[model samples]
Target chain A: MSQGDGIYPDDLKYTKEHEWLAVHGSIGTVGITHYAQSELGDIVYVEVPAAGAPVVGGEEFGTVESVKAVSEIFAPVSGEILEVNPALAAHPETINRDPYGDGWLLKIRLAEPKEIDALMSAAEYRKYIEEEAN
Target chain B: MPPAAGPLKTTPLVRLFRDMGARLVDFAGWELPVQFSSVIEEHLAVRGAAGLFDVSHMGEIEIRGRAALELVQKVTCNDASRLGPGQAQYTVLTTESGTYVDDILVYRRGENEFLLVVNASNTDKDFAWIASWARGDVEVVNASARWAQLALQGPKAVTILQGLLGGPLDSLRPFRFLETEVNGTRSIVSRTGYTGEDGFEIYLPPQAAADLYQALLRAGGPHGLRPCGLGARDTLRLEARMLLYGNDVDETTTVLEAGLDGIVRPAKGPFIGSDSLKREKERGPARRLMGFEMIDPGVPRHGYPIRVGGEASGAVTSGTVGPSLKKSIGLAYFPARAALPGTRFAVNIRGRDALAIIVPTPFYRRPH
Candidate 1:
């Protein structure tokens, strides 16, 4: 289900740090939330782990750098990286343009299925950001 | 998060910032816009057309008395005697150890009157430091509250400002300023800016700030002037290689090491840090600030370690992907021998070493 204006999709699970997980059976596509990309003015460069790398929940897998500061991107769930987005290296601004779709950073095979249940739903994530704004 | 220690100050144009949909953040105890549209868009607008900035947050210290020049010369590293009426000079307040207290601009308002503009973050400290050296007939007043500053920068800056003034702005040479009226408000217009592009900085009364800002926006709208914020300001200055006080230089770094030798004149005779600076010049600075561009994928960031030949070398002070240059550029301190242009080093970015090469600064110079 698509959220209004496609900012946050209902099918995605979110982490407190703003990473979104789109579960597709056992494989999940992970990327930063729209809030995350908006907070980082311009995405000049992104460093992602190569395919086949192991990523654990709550561990930093890469960094998203803007012109002003660098932000660490944490893995939402423990998994093995199946593929990393090749478009990010050349056009990091894609994260700011289409954070939910083409901006997906990686596709991973879940190592902890139970971790997905603990993630926040779309409605809960919206409330989290609303409280954060206040 | 806990609230700030003291109440945050707001500029006269704070309302205007909010009206323009600006994203405001707490910068050095002041509520200022970090960006209006986007950093890259605003930055490019300054490079291609023009951009207006509210620089009222910058501190203004007024020194007035017969001994004003003497007090200024004593506290700053540059020779203030060379400044005639209506001229400005980039100078630095140095400590006894030949380290930076703050980098400032000295504007000669009159023969015995001077206005010192300092970084917003170090306003209190700089005022206190300058006041400590005030003696004789001079009086130091923190006049920041009375004045507001606006910087209109880019290629079309002159055209936009000249339209507002309805005067011959081309006659104003670099580093020169004129006391004139702009849109019925008295102003100090100077042909100076931190950005490497041609621009004008207008200093006027706080009460007249909002009106003049609105007038400029209306006039400059057709000329493609965007309202810029601190985000674009930082990137623009970085692309120009202008040093940001806390980021590029601090009390631990000397003028010589920061590559600002042009402003430090030892021949001018006794001044604060002159002796230590002379000694350092004779012995040669151990570390020097150099500009570099990343050859690898990763972007170097502040406090990132620099390694040369697998040995720890130095640390990056400022780093960014230059919007104009479209490359990752930064400034770092390196051993004197490794500070030359074309020298190669590795920046430790997130546990990985990224290759970078030293390059001559002012990374983006405007084509005349």
Candidate 2:
């Protein structure tokens, strides 16, 4: 997906806090959207929950820090963290350069598959950001 | 929630910043750009090449009369009697309780006239405080509205400024200023800056700010001069270890504890905070400001608690990722015993304790 101008893949589900989820079977890959990274300016540091940590939906799972400020990353759905992006520890700027690819924050095993339906679709997420900008 | 309702004051360069798609924020009642581009990019640009900054929000006060020096010496911690014409001194407006009223630059304009450039947020308070001290033979005038200021800073600063000046600028020493015309606009160009780099600060009439800004941008475009904002300015100054008034020092922070003892000369004799400062110097400050770098992968921010041996020791004052050094560095006040370089401490970053160690400041010193 071209992230040059705020691309939101229709195949993924998004949270109001700008986290996007790509589900593969029972595992869901999570990363911040291009808009989130752009609004953050430069990603200097990111702290994610350890693998096996329980993540509750609508709860903070981690934090994204820019040079200017710190923002909390919210969990899109209840799940168990399976993996974290180890590459982020050394090169957090990858979140700004390629937020959806190498910058994926974590992979999780969904505790409730029905929770995915609560997230917004790609079109809804686009409109949500438009309202926020206005 | 709806946006807070209030009219924001703007500098002459507001439209220019808006035109450049600068991210504007409300700072001390003034609508100013927080960043023109990205903070790191603008910060690196200033360190490698040059960056232009709109610093017109800073307040300027003029003191003129036979007693100008006396009034200045009474309120400031530095000895102004030693300054001759064209020289500037980094000083502080101290309160009677031995705390900082504001950190300012004392520019000796003439034998009986001086100018004080102070922080933006403290302008009104400073004016009132200084005016209260003015008596017979001394006149304090708030000239903030009459002037605009721009800082051109970095390694290429001199070369870029030299291109627009009619006279030789190589002779202008650091901390000294020259009153001259730049592209026909009257200005006071000073070899001073907060970025820990060689640069010049141009103070001119508000009406001439826009024109000079554009002219300098056009002249400096080929040389890689980017228009920076407060975000870059903060990171640059943090790397330089320059104290910000509200963050690093405030009405509660004394000059002695702020690690600015070099600027305080008690031997020069009686000032507003002299008595308390003298006592503090003799007895030694209980707490001292120390610079530390995070040993872990978290950013230590302002108001975060600093821990020593699992116990709270102090609180962070100013913290940021030092772009030049590419590390998380910050300033904090620790007990005298724990303020030494190499002392280990941990900062509470969002409930997680991030290990840090005290280090010698000016985290990123420019190559000479």
Candidate 3:
């Protein structure tokens, strides 16, 4: 669990790319950090992977646009998307306003339990965000 | 007049932007402050109140001699003959194939003197091109270093200037200029701006620029004037649906492609690109520029592919989600049929599909 910087949840594991994953039973919930949303600005558009789409670890899964720039969002773990953020369609700026809550991106059915072990803990993710800011 | 041969420099305004905690970005090889405040706040200040801008990065070149207009008219895509003394005209210089070299706003100081305000990155190239095609027995002196520009833009701009000028500025109207005394120094004030707001573009000596900016800040600060950066100017212009040179039009983009044929007036004179433009106008542009909005949550951007009926038709040249309209707006070249407002299409942004609708250019309008 990571919490040194950014809005890292102690209950979740994270990728260096800034994705946080929360495991519950056989599923994992995923979303970018508050730091990511702050850096991206008011999200204007989102390209979400369709439900049931298989996502490979270290692969791009979606894109987000703010005012003038676009950033690609990557999948943190190999899994199948069970649900995508539907609220983001009309209110993309929610990512900036409430990135960790209403801005949650997707829920995926976990492909491997060992992948979670490789992810960062809350304290580690916080330090990672701080270094990136510099 | 050669390719920019030195490292790019930042203006004092960059420091000001940094002090205001603006997000700095690389623009034209220069580190420019994108937005000091929120893009919406600064943009609305220009549209509603007054917004001050640091436009010192723009290039200025002086053309002096009797052949000034002669050379200028041939070099640009506008009728310079109508530009009397103390008047300005917006025009574009094109290549032999009719693609844009750069867009400029030319100020005619007198019958034999002119000034061309050009895009910063293209300054050297524009100077070189104008020098090589010198039809005028005149001196083309680059004066970008000795001068600076600050734009005070809003509905209240004239009132603020009137207070500073100590007299009515009657001689200056839209596109007109006046050489007046400001702070004991001669300054040129023009009734023009990039934002759709009524405003003034002030030109003064570089040393005097900082003082004048301070005075303007102190005077207008209480009246809701904010020191806006390029970020606000961009969003404001985008709201007005004004075309940005490098974004909406570039070296490979033509007058017709950008829907600027009305300004071309092919019969103006025999000039470079006249033949090509005349033919292109007759043949119709291969693609037409369009304004679009995303129906889905996907912001299309420059270089993003525009698809119609699942076929690649064109690519975006400029794109953004407007702060005012709260919609994703983009400028792209597409088939004439796709240019029609209300036509539906898809934008492929980083391998993701965004449903797009062809909307009219300019997503925002001031109520008349």
Candidate 4:
């Protein structure tokens, strides 16, 4: 999505910090939402935890740096990292281009799947960001 | 977040910027556009063609009277006596200990009159300093609110601005300015800019700024003159190795240590920091601000700890993934002995050390 264009797929859950999680059984995929990447202007660098690292809910797992500022990425639920996007380091701009699809930051094996209930749904996250922009 | 004083101040071009879809952000307590499109796009636009900027937030001070030159000479480090009418020089307002009060551009309007363009956040402080030193026949007035500034910079800058002037701008040498009519509005047009490009900085009455801003955009549309914001400005100036005041140099850093010995002229006379500068020059500064590029994977950020030869020395002052060079470059203070072209250091980014090497700066010099 481009600037001012908002897209929140109903299959995903989002955090107040703007990371989106896609759950499938015991595994989940994570990436920053389109709203977050647009607000960042341009992504130049990204640092993520290695696979098998433990992540806690609402805790910082990595950092996303744009041309002007740096933003910390917080996990929405507790999990163990399964895999990280190896292509993200050299092509950080991919997050700004295809944030939801190819720009996924990491894959995790859920440690507390019930924690997903606390995340905002697509419709709620859309409203959450709309309120944030004001 | 809003500053403690009140809402962020807006420039005269704020509405126009919003109309053009600019992403506004708070910069030094002023609300200004960070970018219209993207930093990389705007940065390359200035390098390839031209880019316009609303720099109206910058402070302007007029020093007028018989002792104008003397008051300016006493406060600033550069020798303002060498400047004649229509000439300008980049100088610094120094403190008693030879540290920077602020960096400014001194423009000589006449033998007994001058104009100082200073940083936006340092306006009141700089004015107070200049006013206190105002003895004899000098008058210091903060004319910041009375003017609006527009910088049209890059290779095509001259061509884009020449049509607005009644005379040619081709003959206006760098650092020279003239009081002329811009789009029929009385303005000060200077052949100087921070982007290291051939350009003009036009200072106009606030009332005439909005209309002139649009006119220039219309005239420059064909030349690919995109309206840039502070994001591009920062990146462009970084590539040129121009230092930002609050970040690169502050009260703790002396002019000599900031790599600005060329502007310190103690031999001319005793200015605010002249005595201290002279002492420091004789002994040589212990530390100096130097440029470096990360050799390992990580981006150096401001306030990041820096280690020179494995010992904690200083902090990163200004850093970014250079939009032009595509390298993580930054400026940092290091021990004088370690300030060399090939000297290697480590930047502590969130407790992780990233190896970096000092490199020759003005990292991306444009082809002449």
Candidate 5:
């Protein structure tokens, strides 16, 4: 119930692990949802795989550490890493501030474009998280 | 993330903070707020102005009757006989091996009355341990359920709390307490805190907690007081190099090894762990706790292995990127030979070894 808690851009597809993917043709930008960042508290550091590394769907490719706990960030769909967020090394709290925009973790080249169809839409994700709360 | 339901214990201020959008987490077994707006913001607020914290989860045990001081002197490692009425001392409940049962605060209420404040998670264990040593007319009671505690910490703490006092608090020095009324409620106000700051810890009845909490916030708003949670508490205490019972010291860590030899009073005569601590003192502790700051980019975390001068050393006990100092600082146990300042270390962060160096502790101290 804090800032950016209710935001879920309609253009982005969501994963059950709390990641959001914004697909643009064959390229997609990935970031954790606002709920994930808020639940993790104050994020101090982030570690992501370097560009050109291939990642499998539903597997951990990076870590997000807050003051008290560490969480794994998973890939929503199998893809090759195109770029990792350089800003995160110095300012990881951007995830808590503007998660949907500047906080994006990585840019990936999609292996299967059809994978987006299987993911949840913004409204569907909102419903999914509501059920998750109970 | 949602309302904490089920078996987790909650403090009296849960509902008030939950309504304020504070993020709650499971600490030990209690459902408590971790942060209000953010940990860094709350931490900075405490350093610049003041912060109010709900510490009602801390356990309180009261001992009364003719043999109260005798029973206290038997179980704790400090010289409690030195305390006059209305004074408090930081001491440890020592195990037979000269290690900690729990680090606690002993308050001498009167000649035959004392109050021991212990860690929340160790309440039941401490009570049972104290009862086993009771061999006289003294009565030991777990008064945790009867009291609610609040900590007002930082430079502005006195200015904010002085408004509610019926009389001036000039007589209340550090580590001193007085039975008084705050904002019309009878309370015990102590000039002590875990954070290295000018603060007061107020203890009152359970039901009166919420009202005083709101009153303090209202009175403290203009003075720049923020409602802080456990996250800020941990960060603040770490910056001050205060030991966390479960993290920095425990049943396996001796007081001497933790660099607390000053608190050990051998001349007070035989107590629990006295004989073993005496022998350890003669031989010197094999390992010692040292404070360090990271020279590399990674943050040191609890239980992470460390290497000193190319050999495996102990793990980190407590660590955080200090909000006040803005540096990654931590405490770890190392071989006594390598425990000095300027010694280099490599802290294992996940699969990578990050560079660290021993530094003088109290990474952040308040400017006078």
Candidate 6:
């Protein structure tokens, strides 16, 4: 915790693109990692798909723009939107101030259960960003 | 090292930021030092006291000849006919459809010499556009390669500049110039700036740039002329209600629609965009540019959907959490009816509704 904001938890599965997924059987809670949101700074706008909108694996799901630049948010696996973060609409900077609690972007029902095991673990994902940054 | 794709180019004070371990961002193809320092702190410096800007990258195009004034009047939005020698005016280069090519400052130096300082990226394009339309004997010259530009701006700018120039500089009115010597180096000093503060913009050769920068840094050292980057430049201009060309006004956005009707002279004879501009001025635009504040948490940025009646009307051109105002403010084009100040609307930020209100242009204005 002293080395800046720490990685979320060992149980969470993370994509190389900085998205994290918590799998409870087939239903998944998908959101950008605390690391991703911190790098992006204040989240001014989020552009996730509709609740019923079907998103494909490795496809662009939405966009998030900060004051300086705009970035595309990608889906790690094919999924359907279950619920979106309603609190983010008013307090988007919570992603920067506190990403794990209030900054979780959306919840989705996964189409592929096998994709979870393919993602890196908290320890591995933390190492990945460090390597990527280098 | 992964086959380095050429070394990055740095300006005079690039080493300062490098030593501080700053993130150098690429802006308009130039490897510029983004934040020395923090964005908000640099931003507040310009708003409160002073900020030094290395606007050397901006291009200067000189329209020279006996027909220079006439050519300028024909090509730009400002009425250059009324301007005497040694006067400057804010103007926009428009297409035949009255759409903006680029906004620039027209400086009338002599009977036949006029300088048009424009945005950096648009330098080649703007020169090509002017060269294509140029009919008279007046030769349009790209003088940017010959000079560097610097902006010394803020509330304390006058005091700092007055001392640097060896006397009072406030006598030069807005959009006016003074042929002065700094360290005995000839410089063209203007009382105009992109920031809303009362400041001076100095133009000189490359060799003289370093000395002037250092002299001002030493003279205004206590007065707070901190070296500001492109980040603060963008924030300050947006707050002052100055339009960004590519964002706020583009090839598709007309001068009238951009709310720059005051600068467009439709009756100034047969120039480009005269007919289209006249018609638009008479008919009024369907969607108009407006300034608004975010009522929700999300800051309204460019391309965010603007909702009028639960549907998309237009989009935001620029938006940010104004450090000075402590609130999210931005500009967008919407239905003329909803363009009213205090009119509330919604911006679609990530499939959610972020409340917004139409406020008057310029979320910040400096005291005249």
Which lDDT values do the candidates have, in the order given?
0.91, 0.91, 0.81, 0.92, 0.91, 0.79
DockQ, candidate 3, vs. native dimer: 0.44
What lDDT would candidate 5 get against the real structure? 0.91
Candidate structures ordered by DockQ, highest first: 2, 4, 1, 5, 3, 6
Worst ten-residue run, lDDT, model 1 chain B? Answer: B1-10
Of the pair 1 and 6, which is ahead by DockQ? Answer: 1
Give one digit per residue, the lDDT tens place, for model 4 in A3-108: 3434888899999999999999999999999999988989999998899899999999899999998999998889899999988988999999999999999999
For candidate 4, what TM-score does chain B get against the true chain B?
0.98
Candidate 1 whole-model C-alpha lDDT, 0 to 1? 0.91
Steric clash count of candidate 1: 0
Interface RMSD of 5: 0.9
- Model 5 misses residue A95 by how many Å? 1.5
Q: Per-candidate DockQ versus the true complex?
A: 0.78, 0.89, 0.44, 0.81, 0.73, 0.21
lDDT of 3 by residue, B1-368 (tens): 23344575776566556666778876787777777655667877877889898888889989888788778877888788888899998888888888899988999999899999999988888999988877748888889888788899998788777777855765568999888876556788999899887889988887788777778888888789988877678877876778888788988889889888867856778777889999998888988888888887656677888888788987887777677677678888888766788889888867677898888866777665
Instruction: Supply the DockQ value of model 2.
Output: 0.89
Clashing pairs in 3: A1-A121, A1-A122, A2-A121, A2-A122, A2-A123, A3-A122, A3-A123, A5-A126, A46-B297
Worst 10 residues of 5 chain A by lDDT: A1-10
Which pairs clash (backbone N, Cα, C closer than 3 Å) in model 2? Answer: none
Candidate 5, residues A1-134, lDDT tens digits: the string is 52353598888999998999998888989999987987888899898889999988788988998887889999988899999989999899999999999999999999988777889998898888888887
Find the 10 residues in a row with the least total lDDT in model 1 chain A.
Answer: A1-10
**Tens-digit lDDT track of model 6 for A1-134:** 11243566777888888888777777777778876765654455666666888877677888776556667887877789888888776666666665666777887789887776678888888888888777
How do the residues B160-254 of candidate 5 rate in per-residue lDDT, one tens digit apiece? 99998987886789999988899899999999998888899999999999999999999999999999999999999999999999899999999
Query: Which is superior by DockQ, 2 or 6?
Result: 2
Worst lDDT run of 10 residues, candidate 5 chain B, spans B1-10
lDDT of 1 by residue, B1-368 (tens): 13247888999999988887899989888899999879999999999999999999999999999999989999899888999999999999999988989999999999999999999888888999999999999999999999899999998988888877856999999999999999888899999998888999999999999999988888889999999999999889988999998888999999999998889987888888999999999999999999999999877778999997678987899898999999999999999988899999999987788899999987988999
Model 3 global lDDT (CA atoms, 0 to 1): 0.81
Measured with C-alpha atoms, the lDDT of residue B35 in candidate 1 is 94
What level of docking quality does candidate 3 show?
Answer: acceptable
